[model samples]
Target: MKKHLSIFKLKPLSMLCFTFLILISSCKKEESDPNEQLQDGNSTVITDLAGDTQAAMGSATPGKEARPFYIFLFRLKDQKQIWIRNATDSAQWLKGKDWDLAFTGPYNSEVYVNDKKYRYNPGFEGNAESAVVMLEQQYDLVDQAPSDQVFDASTITKIGWASSASANGWFFYSLSTHIMQAIPNRTYAIRLPDGKYAKLQLINAYKGNPPSVTDLNWPAPYFTFKYYVQQNGSKNLKTK
Candidate 1:
């Protein structure tokens, strides 16, 4: 009779242990769930952001300098777009850490982080610690940011068109077709100046963010990009 009682008590304890393990597994899964993280308001998606869409293609006349247009500087933290005339006074935007990304060059095709690595880059000579890293994986699949050492080793200054055979960038330019196409599954992992991490996906460059544009006259320089800034100051950038 005592042996039977002992066996019954041992079985209940074993079942309790198994139940505790299952609860632990469920808690871990919930903590790491991408959807739950997104629902907590840690992601942002900016679509159809116009980046100098009205600017002319090239110089209008021979021996005449083309009119310079303002560059769009974006602040990822607040989702604000600040316009700065590059030909004129750009010190307020370029010299400060108020901007995270700079949309420069013709049609705003080139992008630069606010790191003081180059003379013409944003936050030049400032105290910003921002960096950019390009990844070949799709945006949704990139759950973790690479180590800070990896960001330090990256050499991608501009995240624009791949002009040459050996160039690495976000878009592909077809010489025959004269079209700029954003490469699929290309995402940029950015280290914000404030020491937080974010993942950016440059979706399209056309006005409507179309999947494919056959017409050459389709209005362009309009950017459609989405990003998720890990707000908890950790590298958990899992945004589904």
Candidate 2:
């Protein structure tokens, strides 16, 4: 009888040890690898502006000079990779025909995407197919209170003009004597040629610090922003 009891206790202890080993192996397999993350589609990216100082708007004569503009090419879902380019002239812009977004600059504030012009309009809803709408204010960086705002299609209207030179054009940049601002809180909604929707927000234009007249050559034209592109062909910004 004593021998039989010892045998039963040994069996239960052996099973318990086997179960613990299996649990540990399962946990090791479930660990996430950062290197396997997606590089382009359905992911957010930040990049610097690409252009020479000679192409700046106020750097030289207006019509005689070319304004620096950055072009971003987002590949289609069926494609393999993303193509990005930066240009300072019409010829350069022509080379980037596949681009989905444009950051037109001298000051590097205006943004054009999907072959349509956009502006910061506080009152209007931002969701027209042919229009670009953004709010005309800046929110605190740490707070990020504007992220909660709802965005969708049909809430926007097309502005009359193309560039900032016109009276009724989209005014995305704000500059004053004492202060210059980019209205960072504004979020833009756009529909791509591929029938996809995306939401973008401009984070910063300068590299180390905000632009100043005295500090022109501190490695400027760096553009940083966060974007979410809907992968399922839905107009809803939250679907991403």
**Highest lDDT among the candidates is held by which one?**
1
Best-fitting candidate, measured by TM-score? 1
lDDT by candidate, in order shown: 0.77, 0.43
TM-score versus the correct structure, for each prediction: 0.76, 0.46
Model 2 lDDT-worst window of ten:
139-148
Report the lDDT tens digits of candidate 1 across residue range 124-195. 787676788988888888999999998999888878887763566788877676678888887889998889
Candidate 2 lDDT over 187-234, as tens digits, reads 566566455666565555556324233443445455545566677776
Candidate 1: how many backbone clashes?
Answer: 0
Model 1 error, position 103 (Å): 0.4
Error of 1 at 8 (Å): 46
